[model samples]
Target: MSVLVVGASAAGLSTVESLRRKGYREPITVLGAEWHLPYDRPPLSKQFLCGDWDEDRTRLRPDTMLSALEAEFVLGDSAVGLDVERRTVHTASGRELQADAVVIATGLRARVLPDQGGLDGVHVLRTLDDAAALRKDLLEASRVVVVGDGVLGAEIAATARKMGLSVTMAGPQAAPLQSQFGPVVAGLLEELHASEGVHLKLGTAVTGLTDEDGRVTGVRLETGEVLPADVVVVALGAVPATDWLADSGLRLDNGVVCDARCRAAEGIYAAGDVARWQHEDSLLRLENRTNATEQAACVAANILGDAQPYRPVPYFWTDQFATKIQVHGRPSEAAEVTVAEGNLDERRFVVHYRRDRRVVAVLGWNMPKQTRLHRHHLVHA
Candidate 1:
């Protein structure tokens, strides 16, 4: 049975590798829209943008390694439509490929501001191309305005500060990462950014952009304030890249809906940011590299006829301003959070989220041992 995988990001690549390791000798075809090989994206905004790492350093697997796997690599070709009835996929390059099974891992695209002029100085970092362009702008930019206060935005703001560029972050929340880290931790993050000379404009919305000669010159906020910026990085987040699956009828909400085994429907599966799976009696979708890789392995195993379910704890990590933030498990809304080590003043600590007297999630900064202990506790709990 031949297996066809669409996309070359973390999920697709993981699925291929896992399948190969499981002794699947059938024809495996990997199709991707980008020309480059599958590469790690976590370092794009941090190390790559800061000029601390080169392109070779960001690659997840070298071409020689991928070729050794005996998988057919089709680059620069996007899967435009899926013929589920016939178990085939139509590519943008006018090729129809039939497969015994298919995996959709298209991932996501960077969210851009709407109704605003697409100027030259506005940037969004998602792909390698995006990171390269932003890195070029950062080299000569004196001031930068970042929209959104999520992990990506926070990293960009911190990187810009390190490069000696004045940064102003605008978001609707009261503080950065309020939704994920809680208000108290967000406050600490705000203090960290403030210490590095980052201007925080929380509880504000960017109404529009001011342009000169078709290039962005500044941003106009809802409060009628125009913030001058030589470069603008819109890190609002990402949306699933499933527009091509509009007529596929494989169940899609925020992403391609799947079961706990990463199976969407008969003969089809999905993994990565573009996949929403049933977890904890609800549809949960994670847009992190860890989730993508884990889910991909699940898909591969199931495809090999091993009916093993995917039960991950939902872990993620981010490095910003020389600070490493690691998260393990999904914190329930009713979970009570507690600090286990260090404090905000020390700039290093571990926060544990407990649900029903059992630690379910742990977030740590420079506290690897504590993080590992909590992770073990959750796994055995």
Candidate 2:
């Protein structure tokens, strides 16, 4: 029996590697939509965009190392359809491959702004090519307006400022990262960005774009104000790449709905950003990089009928302007945040997020060990 993984990034690659390591010698095939080998994406907005690291540095594993997985690599070929009834996969390149088991890790595609035509100098970072083009634009750009206040937007805004470009960030929230870090921490982040010379426009929505001769000149705000910019980066989040599974009947909602084991159907499973599995009284779908690897590993075992539930604490981190914010567990549901270690004035502290007087999550600001230590409290909670 062969296993087929749809996606060539961390989750797909992890599934392949885990299966091989588990003594499964069955044939495995990985299908990638991108033309290049699978590379790490976290660096695209940081070291890679800053020119501190090259493309090779973003590789999760060397080509030679991945080649040793003994699986067929179908790079540049996208899986357009899945025939779950016939156990067949259809590719855009006209290849009809049969598989005994199927794994969907299609990940996500960047969300584009409404009514924005393909204007030059307007960019979104997701793929290597996206970063390459944005990097080129950043080096020559004098002023940039970044739309969105999420992790991607904040990171790009920080990177652009570090690149010596004047950056003005338009956030729909009162403070950037308010949804993820809450008001207290988010207010601090807003202040940090201000101190670093990043202009912030809070509670403002981007109305449209100002284009001149097929190039975006600036971004128009809902307030009828325009921020002149040589380039604009849309860091708005993303949607799951589940359009191909529309006819597959795999129960698609925000993503591919799956059981606790990451199983979508008989002999079919999903991992990474595309899988929303049942978790602790709710359906949790994490877009975190660590979740991708962990969920893929669980899916690999569950594919072999191990029956292990894919229960993860949901961990993620972000680095901005030398400040590292690490978080573990479900902080979104927390009603209170307490300083577990260190003081807030130091900007290097660990805070515990509590829900109903119980520790639900932990966040560390430049305190890695403390964050990890508190993560243990929620392991069996």
Could you tell me which residue pairs clash in candidate 1? none
Q: Where is model 2 more than 4 Å wrong at Cα?
A: none
The lDDT leader among the candidates is 2
lDDT of 1: 0.88
- Report the C-alpha displacement of residue 262, candidate 2, in angstroms: 0.6
Report RMSD for candidate 2: 1.1
| TM-score for each candidate, following the candidate numbering | 0.96, 0.98
Candidate 2, residues 190-268, lDDT tens digits: the string is: 9989999999998989888999898999999999999999999988899999999889878998999999899888989
lDDT of 1 at 213: 91
Best-performing candidate as measured by TM-score: 2
Cα lDDT, model 1, residue 160: 90
The TM-score of predicted model 2 comes to: 0.98
